[model samples]
Target chain A: MIQDIVTVFIKEFKEILQMRGTKRSGWINILVVIGVMGVYMPLMSGREWVTNLLNPISFAWLPFFLVIGVVADSFAGERERHTLETLLASRLPDASILLGKIAAGVVYSLGIGITSLLIGGVVANLGSLEEGFVYYPLDFLGILWALSLLLALLMASLGTLVSLRASSVRQASQTLSLSMLVFWVGIFLVTRFLPEEARVLLSGFFTPERLPMFVAMVVLGLVVADAVLISVAMLRFKRSRLILD
Target chain B: MNDVIVTQSLTRDFKTVRAVDHLTFQVPYGTVFGFLGPNGAGKTTTIRLLLGLLEPTGGTAHVLGFNSQSEGHRIREQTGALLEHPGLYERLSALDNLDFYGRVYHLPAIQRRSRIQELLEHLGLWERRHEPLAGWSRGMKQKVAIARALLHRPKLIFLDEPTAGLDPVAAVELRNDLAQLAEAEKVTVFLTTHNLSEAERLCGLVAIIRAGKLVAFGSPETLRSRRKNERVEIYGQGLEQSLLPWLDTHFGVRQAGLVNGHLELEWPGDRELSSLVRALVERGVGVEEVRRNKASLEEVFLDLVVDGDKEPYTA
Candidate 1:
C-alpha cells in the first residue's frame, strides 16, 4: 500500500511540474512566487518582519492558496482528460490514490511555503545590513511552520472533496475558490455579530498569556476539519460511482 | 483450452435500465474473442463489469480465475484494459505514458525500460517516443494507449472499440498490428467492436448482442452458416426475369432473383446443382458459369439483430 501510494505520488508530482507544458515553466512559476513572497515582501518589511508576529501570520495564508491551486486539478483534471477511468481501473486501492493525491498537494504547498520563509529570512538579513544576521525567533518559527502546514492540508482536503464531484478542472477551481470565499465571509460575519461577552472572551483567549493556547486551538480545529474533509473525499472516490459520472 | 473469462447469468442494471441482461459466456485463453454489438448494446458496460470497475447487479463473473465481485483487485492486477477512450495523458510523452503504467503494474526497472522500448519499436513509435502525445495524431495516440495496456504483459486484455473512429488505412493498420501482437504475446483478447469485417478477420470466436441480450454466439463461420439457405448464382446471357416466377415456384428454391444478368437462387437445403443447371439450360438460358456464395458475417449480424428486435424482453 505504501509503495502504491508512493508510485501515485511520484506521478502526481511529475504531472504538477509538467502542467504548464514544460518543467522549466513550472519552476519559473515557483521562482516567481518565492521572489515576491520571500524576497520582495520581507525586504520591504525589513527589521519589522522578524520582530512582528503579524508578519508570520500573514505569510501562513500563502500555502492555503498554493494548495488550492494544485489540489483543484487532482481528480477533476484526470476526468477532464479522460484518464481518471484508466487510473481507477488499475490495481491501486482507493485509499492509496486518495492519499497520494493529498500528499502531493500538501508537499508542493509546504515546500513552497518553507522555501519562501527561508528566503525571506535571507532577504531580511541582507536588506537590513545594520541589524546583522537577523532571524525569526525559534518559537515563532515553529508556530509558523506548524500553522502553515495545517492550513495547507486543510485547503487540500477541501479541494479534493470539491474535485471529486466536479466534471472539469475549471469547475473544481471555481467551486473551491467560492467555497473558500464563503468560509472567510462566514468567519468574519460570526466574529462581527458575536455578543459583547463572547467577543470579550475571544479577546481574553488571545492575550499574551493565552496566545499559545489560542494557536493550539486553531491548529486543532484545522486538524479536525482536514480529517472530516479527507474522510468524505475518500468515501466519494468510488470506482463504480466515478465511472458512471 | 483454458478459459480466461467466464460469466454466468451476469447482469447489471443502471437504475431503471438493464445494461447487461444475463450475459453468460466464456472466452478461451489465448484467443481473440470479439464481443460484437451495435451502439448502446452494452459493450462498454460488459467491459467494465469484466474488469471489475463496475459490479454486476446479479449473477457473477470470474476473470482469470478470480471472482470479479470478491477479487477485483487480484483480477485487475493480472489483466489490462483499453477502454472506450484512448485514455492517454496527452501532455506526457509517449514513453512516459507507457512508463507510468509499467510502474503501476510494478515492473522492475530493467524490465520496464526494455519492455517500453520493445513495444514502442514494434508500434513504429520509437523515434517519437520522447515527443508529447499532444502533438501526435489520433492514430499515434491510440498506438501509445495500446502499448500502455500491453506494458504489464497480462494474461488477458480487454479492448473496447479499438478502431472506432479511424480512417480505413489507420483502422486496417491497427487491426493488422493487433492481430500480430495478440498472436506474438499469446494473450487472450476480449475485444468489443461493431465492425463485422474486423471480427471476421481477427476473432476466433464472437458474440453478437442487441438490447443488452445475447442474440448469437459462435465462430464467424458458424454464425454465417446459421442461415440454412445456400445461394447459387448462374451467370448466363439469356437469363430472363420471366423465369424468376418459375424458379420461385420450385420446392427447393426459397427465393430467386435476377442480379446483373445472373440468375441468383436461394436453395433451402442440400439440392443437386446439376439439376438446377439442367433446368436453366432447358429454359433456353445459356449456362455460362455457376458459383456458390456463403452469407457474410455482416449479413448474419444484421439478421440476428433484426430478429432480436422483433422479440420482446422476457424479464
Candidate 2:
C-alpha cells in the first residue's frame, strides 16, 4: 500500500510541476509581486504604506493555488480527457489515486507558498513608503508558509472529492472554486483579528515557529483529519457512476 | 473455478437513471471477452464495477475470486485497465509516468526500471521517453495509457475502448498486443467497445447491451446464428412502391423498409439469393443485385436497440 501511494505521488509530482498553467502562473505571480513591491520600495519612507505592505501573508498564498483550478480539475479532467476510467481500472488502487492527487496539489501549492514567502521577505525589508524604509519581518514568511500547507490539505481533498463527483471539467472546477470561498473567508476573519502584540506570535503559527509543540499539534490534527477524509473519499469514489455515462 | 470475472445482477443507478441494469456476466481465463454497447449504454459503467472503482447500488461482482466492491484493494493488485480517453500528468515524461505507476504496483526500483524499459520499448515509446507528456501527441499519450495499463503484469485486464482515439494502425497494434499478452501471459481480458468490427475480430465471446440492459449474450457466431432475417439488398431504377405488399406476402417477409429506392427486407431465409431475384423478376421489378448480409455485429446491435420489443427476425 505504501509503495502504491509513493508511486502515484512521484508520478503526480512530475506531472503537475510541468503543467503549463502552473508554470506560467508561477512566473506571472512572481512578476506581480515584483511590480507591487517595486512601487512599495520607493514609497516605504511613508508610515501609512508600511502596514499595507507587510500585513497579509494570508492572501499571498491564496492566489497561487487559484491556479489549482487545474489541480481541482485533475480527476474530472482525467475523465474528460478519458483517462480516469483507464486509471481506475489499472492495478493502481483508489487510495493510491487519492494520495497521488493530494501529493500533487501539495507540491504545487508549496511552490506558490514558497515563492510568495520569498517575495514577502523582499517587500517587508524594502518597506512600502509607510515603513519609512523597513525590513520585512521574517514572521510573516512563517505564517504564510504554514497557512498555505494547512490550506492545501483541506483544499486538495475537497478538490479531489468535487472532481470525483462532478460530471464535467467545467462543473468540477466551478464547484471546487466555490469551496475555496470558505478558506479565503477564514483567512479574512483570521487576518482581521491579528493584534499587533500577537502578530509575531500568531505569525509564529504561520512560520516554522519553534513551536515544536504547535507543530506536533498541527501534525496530529492533520493526520487525524487526513485519515478520516481519505477514507471518506475512498468510500465515496464510484467508478461505475463515473464511467457509466 | 477458472472464471476470472463474474457479476451477479450487478446494477448501478443514478437518481432516476439506470446506468447499468442488473448486469450479470463473466469471463473465464484465457478468453478475450468482448462487451458491446452503444455510447451511453453502460459498458463503461460495468467495467468500473468489475474493477471496484464504483460500488454497485445493487447486486455484486467478483474479480480474481474476491468481492470486487469491498475487497477492491486486493483485486487491484492483479488487474490492469485501459479506460476510454485515459489521462496522465502532462508534465511528466513518458518513462517517468510509467516508472511512477510501476511503483504503485510496488515493483522494486531495479525491477521497476527494467519493467519500464521493457514496456516502453515494446510500445515504441523509447525514443520519446524523456519528453514531458504535455507535448506528446494524442497517439503518443494513448500509448502511454496502454503502457500504464500493462506495467504491473496484472492477471486480468479491463480495456474499455482501449483503442478509442487511436489511428487505425495504432488500434490494430494495440489489438495485436492484447492478443499476444493474452496468449503468452495467459491474461484474461474483459474488453468493451462500440466498434463491432473490432469486437468481431478480437472477442472470443460477445455480450450486447442496450439501454443499460443485457439484450444478447453468446459466442460471436452464436449471436450471428440467432439473427432472424436474411437481408438481401435490392437495387433497381424503378421498383414501384406498389409492389411491396406483393413482395412481403409472396416472399414471406414479415416487414420491410425502403431506402433510396432500395428495399430492405426482414423475412425467412432462402437457400439461394437467386430465388429472391426470381421472385422480384416475377413482379416486373428489376433485381439489380442481391447479397446476403451474413448478420454483422451492427445488425445484432440494431436488432437489440431499434427493434425494442418488435417482432423477432424469423429467417
Candidate 3:
C-alpha cells in the first residue's frame, strides 16, 4: 500500500508539472508563482519580513490558496479528460489513491510555500546589509510551517470532496471558490461590521496573557477539521460509486 | 477451471432501466471473446462489471476466479482494461502516458522502459513517443492506449470499442495490430465491439445482446449457418421487377430484389435452385450466370438484432 501511494504520488506530481501542456509553459508558471510569492512580496516588505512574525503570518495562507487552485482538478479534471475511470479501474486501493492525491496537493503547496519563505529570507538579508544575515525566529518559523501544512491539507481534503462529486473541473473550481469566498467574507464581516462593544469584548477575550491558549485552541480546531474532511473523502472514494458517476 | 471468466445470470439495473439482464457466459483461457451489442445494449456496463468497477444487482461474476464484487482489486491486479474512451492523458507525451501506467502496475524502471519501447515500436509509434497525446491523431492516441493496456503483460484484458471512431484504414490497421499482439502475448481478451466484421475476423466465439438480453451466442460460422436462408445472385436478361413478386410468392422466397440490375433472391435452404432457374428460363429470363452466396456474420447479426430472437446458442 505504501508503494502504491508513492507510485501515485510520483505520477500526480509529474502531471502537476506537465499540466500546462509543455514543459516550458509549466516552468513558466512555476517561475511566475515563485517570483510573486518569493521575490515581489518579500521585496515589498523589506527587512521587517523576517523579524516581524505578523508579516509572515499575513502571507502564510498563500499555500492554502495555492492548494485550492490545483486540488479542485484532482478528480474532476480526470473525469473531464476521460481518465478517471481508467485510474479507478487500476489495482491501487481506495486509500492509496486518495492519500496520493492529498499528498500531492499538500506537498506541492508546502514545497512552494517553504521555497518562497527561504528566498524571502535571503532577499531580506540582501536588502538590509546593515542588519547582517537574519532569519525568522525559530519558534515563529515552526508555527508558520505547521500553519501552512494544516491549511494546505484542509483545502486539499475539502477540494477533493468537492471534486469527487463535481461533473467538471469548472464546476469544482466554482464550488471551491464560492466556499472560500464565503468563509473569508464571513470573517471580514465579523471583524469590520461588528458592533464596537462586541468587538472590544471579542478582542478582550484574547488578552496577551491568554494568547497562547487562544492559539492552541485555533490549532486544535484546524486539526479536527482536517481529520474530519479527510475521513469523509476516504469514505466517499469508492470505485463503484465513482465509476457510475 | 478452463475458463478465465464465468458469469451466472449476471445482472445490473440503473433505476428503471435494466442495463444488463441475466447475462451468463464463460470466456475460456487464451481466446478472444467478443461481446457484441448495439448502443445502450449493456456492452459498456458489462465490461465495467467484469472489471469490478460496478456491482451487479443480481447474480454473480467471477473473473479469473475472483468474485467481482468482493475481490475487485485482485481481479484488477491481474487484468487491464481500455474502456469506452482511450483514457490517455492528452497533456502528456505518449511515453509519459505509458510510463505512468507502467508505474501503476509496478514494473521496475528498466523493465518499464523496455516494455514501453517494445509496444510503441511494434505499433509504429516509437518515433513520435515524445509528442503529447493531444497533438496526435485519434488513431495514434488509440494505439498508445492499447499499448498502455498491454504494458503489464496481464493474463487478460478488456477492450471496449478500441477502434470506435477511427477511419476505415486506421480501424483495420488497429484490428490487425490487436490480433498480432493478442496472439504473441497469449493473453485472454474479452473485447466488446459492435462491428460484426471485426468480431468475425478476430473472435473465435461471440455473444450478441439486445435490450439487455442475450439474443445469440456462437461462432460466426455457426451463427451464419444457423439462419435457414439460402441466398443466390442471378445475372440474367429480362428479369424484370414484376417477377420479384411472383418469385417471392411461388418459390418460398423470403426476399427478392433487383440489385444493380441483377436479380438477388433469398429463400429457405430447403428450396431447390434448379427448379427456380427452370421457372425463370420458362418465363423468358435469360440466365447467363447463377451463384450461391454464403450468409455473412453481418447478415446473421442483423437477423438476430433486428428480429429480436432471444434464444441463446453456444458452440
DockQ: the better of candidates 1 and 3? 3
Candidate 3 stretches greater than 4 Å from native: A193-198, B309-315
Candidate maximizing TM-score: 3
DockQ of each: 0.74, 0.44, 0.82
Better of 1 and 2 by TM-score: 1
Query: Relative to the unseen true structure, what is the C-alpha lDDT of residue B173 in candidate 2, on a scale of 0 to 100?
Result: 83
Spell out the clash pairs found in candidate 1.
none
Q: Select the stronger candidate by TM-score from 1 and 3.
A: 3
The CAPRI-style docking tier of model 1 reads: medium
The candidates, ranked best first by TM-score, are: 3, 1, 2
Q: Give candidate 2's fnat, 2 decimals.
A: 0.82
Worst ten in a row by lDDT for model 1 chain B: B306-315
What iRMS does model 2 reach? Answer: 3.0
Compose the digit string of candidate 1's lDDT tens values, residues A70-128: 89899999999999998988888999899999999989888988899988887877766
Per-residue alpha-carbon lDDT of candidate 3 for residues A30-149, written as tens digits (9 for 90 to 100): 788889878888888888888776877865798899898788889999999999999988888899899999899889889888888888877877777886888887887888888889
lDDT of 1 by residue, B1-315 (tens): 388999999999999999999998888888899998889999999999988999999989999899999899998899888898899887788888888889899999899999999999999999999887888877777788888888999999989999989888999999998998899998899999989999999999999888788888888888777675677888877988788777767654647888877778877646677887888788788888998889888877776776664432221
In model 3, chain B matches the true chain B with a TM-score of 0.97
lDDT tens digits, residue span B200-309, model 3:
99999889888888878877788888877868999989978899878867876758899998988886787678998899999999999998988888887787787774
Alpha-carbon runs more than 4 Å astray in model 2: A21-82, A91-96, A99-245, B135-137, B165-181, B233-246, B254-267, B270-293, B311-315
